[model samples]
Target: MSRYESPRVNAGAAKVVLIVLIVLVVAGLVAASSVKIVDAGTRGVLLHWSAVDLTQPPLEEGLHFVTPFADDVINIEVRTLKYERSTTSASRDLQTVRTTVTVNYHPEKEMIHYLYKNLGLDYENRVIQPAIEETVKQVTANYNAEELITKRPLVKADIQDEITDRLNEFNLATEVISITDFEFSLLFSQAIESKVEAEQKAFKAENDLLRIQVEAQQQEAQAFGIANANIAEAEGEAKAIRIINQALAENPNYLEWFKTRAWDGKLPLVVGEGGTPFIQIPISP
Candidate 1:
């Protein structure tokens, strides 16, 4: 008391400053809590006392304010989302096939409230995933393993169409749905591969047989053409020989050079029976 006069006054001043700081902090908290920021690539669903306003739609990216105690904000992603599912199921042929499917989807902004109200927050886990699985099962059940592999594109389209139609009733927006891979049992797959190889080999063998048959026919035709040509040539030559023989008989001297040429540069060792001979001997000095 002697050294520090009025300890009570100092205590009161400290209490006053503490009260002011507390008030400032409470006010700051209220203000900060009331203001909410919606970022790009997202939308906010506003509800008053848990009642959504469908007419106004979700607020776009910006700052918004509401009574902190009375209102709430639900942020939803408006962009595309991908879901991959792998499942093993049976085909119409009772063959078990493992399949992987991809689905692209997003919530319709206009129908967001309906989806949230009906299917709730876990729609992907609940509605979309189950719908995809069921649709895939149904589609695969109608097709065989070979069709699943060869006509997969068409199968995917059918699956997408069916799933989309089913989910649309629940207010989900679907972009694209496709089957990426179809895997069968190891033994079954090997069997199919072997069968395909055998079919291809059979086709090649048939083609080879056809080609060989065609070649043989072509050779036969060529041989026949050559035989006919030779026959015609021989007949023409024979007619010419007959005419020449008649000329030789009509004028024997006229046929001397012709007869010499007919010997083809080699005199006959023996004369023909009943035929004139043309051999001349020259005297040597």
Candidate 2:
């Protein structure tokens, strides 16, 4: 026999090589299944044997190692996320209203696993959004559409507060909320506009009435003043005429002096009855 066995040993060596290749492939597969990477702004929930591992904390962002083909990772976003929805409801006055809202929120880091277990990825849609709609309706029912427009800030605050309280059960915290849009029915809008216009017209009419009253009072005061002035002037003239008559009775020549002083440069067109004609006789002065 030769020192090396024929084909049997060679076959045995081939079997060993095949066994090593299979082991390496299995190891590669295990490693491939074990390693996982969680990107930024996300946390990974761990599931061991298809059941969640409650004791284990959520895997932070980056590479993680879990049991190959046994443990699974469910990525839960911990970053702030915006959820927008529209709601149509009736106001307190039964006016139809359409409202749009944007809610900014994030998972409670400590309760994320609990959130996932309870609500899952549809958390916002199932819980948060529904809660928002309900809250908006509850608050909106208390105010008319007109009050809603005037009290928008108050309404927004009420809705945000109520929704936050409701979503607390889902382990979600609301960061910010905005009521982006509000609309009333066409009839309501037109009625509001007409009401405003009527109020403006009524106000203008009131102002016009006040202005007229003030002007009438001022004109009355002015007329009274003019009448008093005329009365005083006539009384002064009568007093002067009485004084002149008394002086003439005391001294008859005073009338001639008065006539001489009262003469103007122009002659009368026609002398009055029994009055002196234009006879400028030269006086021996």
Candidate 3:
């Protein structure tokens, strides 16, 4: 071939190569647009021309095909998700209460399309957070601020049930709910502390009073026993003296014999004028 012809052929071949590259790139773009991947724990919602396709069920996890440039797949997570919020509300006793709550939830796989259509990707904010806030307020109003703290499990259950029921209206499933914290006003907290202190003091006082009463009763019983013993001893001594006197009265000679037995044989060296000798012999009876 002539040199000129060779250049034209080379240029032609280059043009063909460029065209093939363009076609391949366009095909790749189309393929990429037509294919969708729904990840694990997620479901795909198809949008036809920017509108949700309600007639179709959500696509399960894995690869899916769609019409290029006319359809789109929006992946919605159906796995359990955590939502935490701090809210303030009023109790039945009109006390302000602050509560922090955490909820675990997931979108219903079958209802993802409807969920996306209604609430969009920000469902946690639009539905869950508001639901938790409202539910907390509503349930808190049914109890006093003290009860909210003391009966924490019951409060958590009430709030959970309310939130679950509310979120269910949006096609969301609740897995678990937790009440992380409950806060009362400073004044209320101080009041509770004071009340507890007072109760403790009262209990201590009552115990002390009982102890004192028991001690008093024991002392009274001891005194009564001592008095009874003294009285019984006095009566026994009096009875003995009466018996001895009766014996002496019944026999005058008995008295003389007692005196003789009691006397020692002795004489005084100097006797007083009106005194007799210490040794006295009783006259023969």
Candidate 4:
């Protein structure tokens, strides 16, 4: 009976070993099935057996899981990126100009795969730089040196708009574009400056001439007013003189009346013997 019990105990030990091996295999499978990590400010796009799975939008930050051996993961940055280009070209007037530009951009998450496929990491070299150069050249060809210096903002806007339109057609998103700096030949700069100064001087001289003309007009108007007033006053005086002369010529008795009035007002109190006695009239007309 003891010997039979010993064999049964060994059989139970074998069963326990087999169960441990099975558990170990299951644990290994589980570990291999689930394992992934996502970095900060990044997202992971998962593909199962080379086919994309849209059920989950991109995996968020921190650790994540998938069918480890069967799934492929792509990590994409979700941060803004900056690109700068400094290029030189010839203007319409055959002048050399150097321009520096900076752009802020980022990939559209949904279109990252497309971007990766169509334009790789060198997309700026293949697309943006050429586009910038072409557009700038076109705009610069349309404007002269004076316009470039004076209308810088307008020119910048035109270039930005044109580039933005072209990039949008290619499905790339743009955040900001800035013209950083520019350089012109010393001779060209001096010439433009001189031209601008001459224009300003001409404008000032024209304004001075206009002011002088206005002052002259005002003086002439004042002089004409004074002459007209003097003429009117002289005509009035002449008319009064003519009326008095006409009255004197029409009535000769005016002189006798004048003399009689004058004689009564005068006094001499002396009389001669042959002369009639002088009498004073009292209240008789």
Candidate 5:
């Protein structure tokens, strides 16, 4: 080993090292581009620009190899995934309603290859989202604002059914759909409240009128009862007088007998028109 380091020697060593480094870098990139790892719950679609090799089957989860730039493997989800959308639409009564909807869905594993070839990577925005929006609007339009609140489950079912049918045509399967929340404009809610209040007040007024009518009828019935009782008493008194007259006609001495029966033990002294003693004492024979 010489302590005198040669510049030419150092240059040769540097060249050799640089070449090795370049080869290593090239090898790494080629290796990376050659193989791909598809995750579980996902399927892959292969594309070779403008060429469909019918023999190449769809790729399942695991490792795969392909030409670096000539081919591309796009992964499509095959497992259930949630998508949420919030949109505003009009009800049957033309009230604006805001709804948040969630859908759990997945592309068909065997059919996703066709989807990738046709729809490309923008399937969610181009197909699924638009389908959901259209179905939501269509279903919401069938129900009034109050019915939308009261029959929320029915509304959701109709929406989901429409969406599921539409997505099925595009080779997508729906697992579930949930409506997270529903909101209406502040003005509409206030209007509903005002209407309800007015109806309640009207109902109360009607009840009050019915109660007053019933009380009036009760008073009239009471007055009629009192009049009937007074008439009966007068009739009984007249009948009694008629009977006494008849008895007197039957026997003239009956009057004296009646007077004697009616007299009390005490007698009052009286003056007659002749100014003589009017007192008459009855003696028992």
Candidate 6:
């Protein structure tokens, strides 16, 4: 009897199915909106109907639940980020200086909502960049071009401190700042190079002069030693001659004895015309 349903009943059934489908779809959307996932290294800033909620702390990493369809979560990365900028400024000496700097920073997690409210996500361009540029320019202007190159560590510290203090006012934490590169006008660079080259040459010249002086001193010492040795030998020879003379003057017989000791057994090859031997004996008086 009811093999086929009436068109009215079929129409009513179709309406119910469509209504259920619509409800399920709405429920799915609501559920999706209710859940929020704050990824790792990021914090969620909750907003109520487009208004930032300042009363609550930022939602930490992981799943969170919020009012469906009425609340929104804005993710702000709390992890370290790098920002690099190239800036041109003037040194105290009125020299044009170009500098490239890098800054590692992150927003304070507790104050992320405020950061989002005030500077939004593009804070790097709005705040940090300008702060870096201004701080570099200001700090650079305090040092001469040569001082900027020579006192690089001090310059870096000054710039970093300035940037840190400036960013702290906006709840952005600066981890570290690096002065990656420095450049000057070609003429200035060449002048610096020439100055350095001159300094190096001067140092070498000083060292060479010292070495030469040392060598001269060594030569003088050697000559003095040799002269003393020659004088000593001459004095010894004269002393020997004086001792021999004294021996001979004290006793003329010593001469005969010395001659006899020095003579060989062989006789003289030549004889006097009178056929007498040329050797004569000294008589002691």
Identify the candidate with maximal lDDT. Answer: 6
lDDT digits (tens) for residues 236-262 of candidate 1: 999999998898899977565554556
For TM-score, candidate 1 versus 2, the one ahead is 1
Q: State each model's CA lDDT, in order.
A: 0.83, 0.89, 0.91, 0.77, 0.85, 0.93
Find the 10 residues in a row with the least total lDDT in model 5.
275-284
Q: Per-residue alpha-carbon lDDT of model 5 for 137-156, expressed as tens digits?
A: 99999999999988988998
Ranking by lDDT: 6, 3, 2, 5, 1, 4
Clashing pairs in 5: none
Cα misplacement distance, residue 168 of candidate 4 (Å): 3.4
Ranking by TM-score: 6, 1, 2, 3, 4, 5
Window of ten residues with lowest summed lDDT in model 4:
275-284
Position 258, candidate 2: lDDT: 73
Native-to-model Cα distance after best TM-score fit, residue 65 in candidate 5, in Å? 2.6
| lDDT score, candidate 6 | 0.93
TM-score of 3: 0.71
Q: Which residue ranges in model 2 land beyond 4 Å of their true spot?
A: 1-6, 206-285
Tell me the number of clashing residue pairs for each predicted model.
0, 0, 0, 0, 0, 0
Best by TM-score: 6
Output the TM-score of candidate 4.
Answer: 0.65
Clashing pairs in 3: none
- The alpha-carbon root-mean-square deviation between model 4 and the true structure, to one decimal in Å, is 8.2
Q: List TM-scores for all candidates, in order.
A: 0.81, 0.72, 0.71, 0.65, 0.57, 0.86
Error of 6 at 14 (Å): 1.0
- lDDT, candidate 5, at 4: 57
Question: TM-score for model 5?
Answer: 0.57
Clashing pairs in 2: none
Tens digits of per-residue lDDT for model 4 on 13-60?
999999999999988887766777777776677768866666656777
- lDDT by residue (1-285, candidate 3, tens digit) is 597799899999999999999999999999999999999889999999999999999999999999998999999988889989999999999998999999999899999999999989999889998999899899999998888878988988888888989999999999999998888899998999999999999999999999999999999999999999999999999998898799889986676677678776665576656787554558778
Which sections of candidate 3 miss by over 4 Å?
Answer: 1-4, 210-285
